[model samples]
Target: MKAKLGISPIAWWNDDLPELSDDVSLEECLRQSRSAGFTGIEKGRRFPDDPTVMSSILKMVNVALCGGWFSGTLVNEDIATNKHRIQPMIDLFKAVNAPCIVYGEVGHSIQSDRSRPLATKPVLSDADMKAYARRMTEFGEWCAGQGMPLSYHHHMAAVVQFEHELDTFMKCSGEGIPLLFDAGHLAFAGGDVLRVIDNHHKRINHVHVKDIRGPVIKALDWRTQSFLDAVALGAFTVPGDGSLDFGAIVQKLAGYGYEGWFVVEAEQDPRKNPPLRMAEMGYAELMRVTTKAGYVVEAPTFPWR
Candidate 1:
């Protein structure tokens, strides 16, 4: 099946949220995203929190509600707290008619705190994984009732950063909960994107198609800086400008029968590269890569390249 292309509003919100400026309003962001050839957009917290309002705005823009990121501290936080955090987002998804909610580890680590003295160590232990799995099972059941799916986002700096962590999380996660494969984040965290897809293609429910500069990634590693620090330094860029092998990765995802949004999520400075320009470049590259991989390309209604 052909997958739809979408852009994450988080890209604009990075700078837009701090300014609280009129320029980055939800309506404006959606307008720009649609004009930039994106069929859908991922919701950000800065967007309207009220589902009805958010849905109405999206309907007006002719944009679909692609799934979005939600902060979940399942590893360290208590089950009650986690449940409370998850239910509202799930309700929002149902209200907006979004198929899924992308989740990631938040707050504390599941690994030993000593692994990275400066940063929070991953807290995802075997016991913690089991508890998380149970919580996920409950969440999945809740999502099913709402006609939505919960796709866990394995992130860098989070508990499931590296390949081993991903393996553990998958092995311990609830049976039906799907995974959100983010290629750039996986590469930044020192995991092979294609390998991960090859090994666990069955679990992927959605994907975040981000690309990063190879040398920047290496330099960031050499400095041992934080992920946010790297972002501030311009580690990510439009797909073709970066070193990632998207042609191979897209083909792998297709082989697995994956049918979900390919979200362009390059978190960079808008001052350096305006939102519209970045979107244009990224959207074009996405089409090129997907087309090169032998996937049927959909003609975008908005500006592309």
Candidate 2:
């Protein structure tokens, strides 16, 4: 199957840290995305909540709506509470024709924290881990039934960030919960990207393809810097411009027969990197690598029913 290329608006107007590009308009985000050869876009803060409004706006740029992040508080809340929180978004998603919702556990996440470092982020005990897994799996199953598949996102400041946590979650999660394979975050958390793809590709329903600046990562007092602090300093970057091996990663995905959006998402300051230029660079390198891996990059379309 052919792969689709999309880009997130976070590069233009970050939702977590709006101050990053608070002035960049949603119109410019989609326009630059189209200019950069992306056929789809993930949601950002400025994006219209009304599906009709969003669809009409995207039509001008000829970009499809890929998916958007859905913050889940299931670690501290029950499945019902989390489901209620996500249902409204799922309703809007159906109208915009999004394939899935990117589920991120933010109950104890410090991805947006600036005062405290990432090292002091949240941790779940053994029982809490099991409870989270059960709730997420149940919620994910419900989401799929609602035509909005849940693609769980693992981040650097979340309880599910480490290899052991991720493996446990994957082991406990039923078939309803699918992995949102994010190469950059996996690498940022010090995990092997290819190894993760080899293990979880079967359960992957979505993908986020980004690169990291190794020097910046190495220079960081990792225990002291927050995820947002790293972003402010340009820790993440487009694939070819950074140290990540996109060719090997794409080859591995092809081997797994992965089919979905290879969404280019590098959370960098738009003023310095220029979202349009970075998007173009990311798209070009992804195309080159995927093609060499015997994959075709195509226009975006809804995959989940």
Candidate 3:
């Protein structure tokens, strides 16, 4: 099996909670990621929207563009509106040759709202989920036609947070909407990570190798604590440092012939866990696990090199 290691800029600079971010520029983030042995980095707010500018910035560290999140409001919005809103990112990702665009449905999501409790997250009925899934399939198809595929992200504090909700959404949706397998979010929502991969391995186009602190997650009172509260309590960390067994996770993915980017995407306070140190630790753990999985881990190939 073949694979590539990547890291998300959210570890360095969080867009949702700016206070958790490190005081660093876009170039610095890329440099640190590369220094930690990651040859690819995901998009962030500091990244230039212009494709040319973004490419130039990434070239400085010989890092390739992997994937980035798009807050999709397709739960309530129409296809045309979302299509228009996503055109720039589609164009940018296509230009950079990214694997896929991470689609996280943010409509009525309380992930960023500190005042709202986790128990108060939005929920939809079976019929409602079917309708929403149809729309998502349509959107995903359109994105693929535009040369940028959509990988749906089932996040905590969102509509499709739980395992049953994800299963229902997947059953309703078609192959057009591929899944972005996130181990941390699924574990945080009380789902079996291995079970999710076993069920949806067919539709998984992208992967987020996120790890979480089980104790911190279990200590949170869903009725009174928010997702951000859990984050503030150091609920998440990179692999090998936290509770997830990435060795088994990577081995399972390799068994399915999965060859794509395995991105480290732990979002926590940069002050508590220094970004450079965390990046190195994540890269080390991934190297250990991916090597054990028999993956020939590849590095970035710069066109101008």
Candidate 4:
């Protein structure tokens, strides 16, 4: 399976906290992404809404437009309303020729709640899980009809974060709702990455290859700090700098025939972890790992790069 490396703009500008990289420009983001040997970019709030303008900006640095995080309210709202909320992003994805859209169900999540501790993340009852799964399936199928796949992102403070929670959600949801395998989030939740791969590799259509500092994670007071608090404390880092065994992870992904963008997505403070340097570090490490796994990092026939 061939793979391409992509870097998320969140390293430059975070979505949850706009003040993180407030000084960085869009031109800087794209330039650094390409300079770091990335062929694609997972856009964030700093990205333009106009597809034509977005394309022109990214084209300047040979960076293809990859998907970004999309927050969904399926568990609390109607499917039609949810579709309406995401249609603009769908339109943007279509115009940019992106592969798929990464969706995180954050209707009741405390991931962004700086006032509340992450340990207080919302939970669903058995009946609520079933309802949420059904809604997710129906909406994901609708997204598929628009020629854009919706890979459900299991986030730390979201409804489906743990391994068992994901198991239940995926088992109950329709086939249209694929999984977005994010290594950092899984490790942060104390879930096994390989275990998820062994169980749900067939349904994984997108990947977020982020690494985490185990000590920072071990010191995190999820009972007293929010997700952003941990981020502020340097909980996440680039691939090779952290404790994740990404080489082994890549080998497992290759064995499962995973073909798509391996997005380097880690939400870190740009002031402490410079975006360009970390992007290069992540690219170098991922290139080494993917090459060892028999996959070449090459540019696909996309709109740009």
Model 2 compared with the native: what TM-score?
Answer: 0.96
lDDT string, candidate 1, 75-126, tens digits: 6666578667778777777776676888766667422122343144455677
Maximum-TM-score candidate: 3
lDDT of each: 0.75, 0.86, 0.92, 0.88
Q: Candidate 3, residues 1-305: lDDT per residue as tens digits? A: 88999999999888888899999988888889999999898888989999888878887888998999999999988889999999999999988878889999999999999999999999998899999999999999999999999999999999999999999999999999999999999999999999899999999988999999999998899999999999888889999889998999989999888889999999999998999999999999999999999999998565446
Candidate 1: where is the Cα deviation over 4 Å? 15-23, 109-120, 221-224, 297-305
TM-score-based ranking, best first?
3, 4, 2, 1
Model 3 spans with C-alpha error above 4 angstroms: 301-305
Give the distance in Å from residue 131's predicted Cα in candidate 3 to where it truly belongs: 0.5
Every candidate's CA RMSD: 4.4, 2.0, 0.9, 1.2
**Model 3 Cα displacement at 15 (Å)?**
0.9
Which regions in candidate 2 have their CA more than 4 angstroms from the true location? Answer: 302-305
Worst 10-residue lDDT window for candidate 3 reads: 296-305
Q: Estimate each model's TM-score.
A: 0.87, 0.96, 0.98, 0.97
**Best candidate, lDDT-wise?**
3
Two-way lDDT contest, 1 vs 4, winner: 4
